[model samples]
Target: MTTSAPPNPSGEDESPAAGTSTTAATSTTRRTTTVTSKVPTVTAAPTSPTTPPATQVTTSTSAAPATEIPDAPGPLSPAARLEEVGTATVDGDELVVVAPSDTARADARQGLAALEIWLNGGDPGSTWTTFAATDPTSDGWRWAAVNRRTGAVVYIR
Candidate 1:
């Protein structure tokens, strides 16, 4: 299903089979040039081994604007940070960690958001278990939470 252009004598591709024709364009103009150059050599007299190159030092007097350092963010309370879960919402007293949408794209920021939510006010470690698993039907990645004490699945998406 492929064809190559015919070999050309001038080294420029002029093959019509290659989707290009250069015959008229190539004959429009011609150029010729000649170049000349001269180089001179000189010998230097040897100096004493103790002689060193002169050194020059310079300093600028212009004052530069002072850069202000930004204040660091204060520490976040447990309720301010999200757990490794994607997103979280408060439903009554329970903290629900929602999985990130694959179509929307998942990344480290989402994971950090989840972690922050978990740290903030999500379920305590003793109440729920968060684990990653592959869905058997679609073979896609998923995160699920199970209530340890109740043996109930919280969310899977």
Candidate 2:
């Protein structure tokens, strides 16, 4: 008597070919083993002989514009911008400081103190000396502290 084998779960043929492994066993018991793979199988669609392949185009949202940015303005120059305005006047080589009101004078004094602090490293010591009336020496930096808002000037040597 002959017995037939069972079908595979995936419906694919797993049986040995005809005339292959034709050795006769001593026992009637049959042990069937099926192996499954974890890898997946991919299949491409059937294309016609005269049909052309398709093209793909991609765009990026993070791309920036190619326009040029404007240049920023630099710090103001005291000599060029800070001229005699309002009550401040120029007396020969010196700047004669004359404010319109007491408030203007106070502001001018604050500006003068700021300029002095800037020149003397926050502490104006004996390094800051007044120029002589008769013979003024050109040794250190001579600056005219001008208030940009009120246009008040104070000359320092």
Candidate 3:
């Protein structure tokens, strides 16, 4: 009796070769396993390009040229501009005051009180004196707080 095995290139199966184990020697080569990967593709949806019925978009722009604007006047401007720009800016909120001399301080307090009276819709105080006349010691140096737009004195002697 005679036996023979088939040739296997993979060498996975240890089956006897056709002429090797059965006859004299079988032939086979060692092989390593290899893996390959494949990926699927993505597709977009279909949209219809239908036309509009009759009207809608009127793309007209009415932009004017840029104009330069003027600046507004400051707060404490007595006539056109106050002589007291850098001196001090006074508002209605400020109340008590101190003067260089007691006489000036007294006159200022009286003036402020008279202003308050005027604001309250009443007659202003009567016996108020102006340092321009009474205090010649200063020799024409008189201090005052006047209204900007109307040139009305707000405080001082």
TM values, all candidates:
0.22, 0.23, 0.20
Give model 3's clash tally.
Answer: 4
Candidate 2, which ten residues in sequence have the lowest lDDT sum?
68-77
- For candidate 2, the C-alpha RMSD (Å) to the true structure equals 16.4
Candidates sorted by lDDT, best first: 2, 1, 3
Q: Give per-residue CA lDDT, model 2, range 1-157, as digits (tens).
A: 3444455565666556522344654564444667777897888998869855486666769867543311211222333323222232223223333222322454555545544454544543332222212322332224444444444444443
For candidate 1, give the lDDT of residue 10: 55
Error of 3 at 108 (Å): 1.7
What CA RMSD would you report for each candidate? Answer: 27.1, 16.4, 16.5
> Against the hidden true structure, what lDDT does model 1 obtain?
0.40
Off by over 4 Å in 3: 1-103, 129-157
Backbone clash count for every predicted candidate, in the order shown? 17, 0, 4
The order of the candidates by TM-score, greatest first, is 2, 1, 3
List where candidate 1 sits over 4 angstroms from the true fold: 1-124, 135-141
lDDT tens string, model 1, 104-123?
12333343344345545564
Q: Which candidate is the best by TM-score?
A: 2
Preferred candidate (lDDT higher): 1 or 3: 1
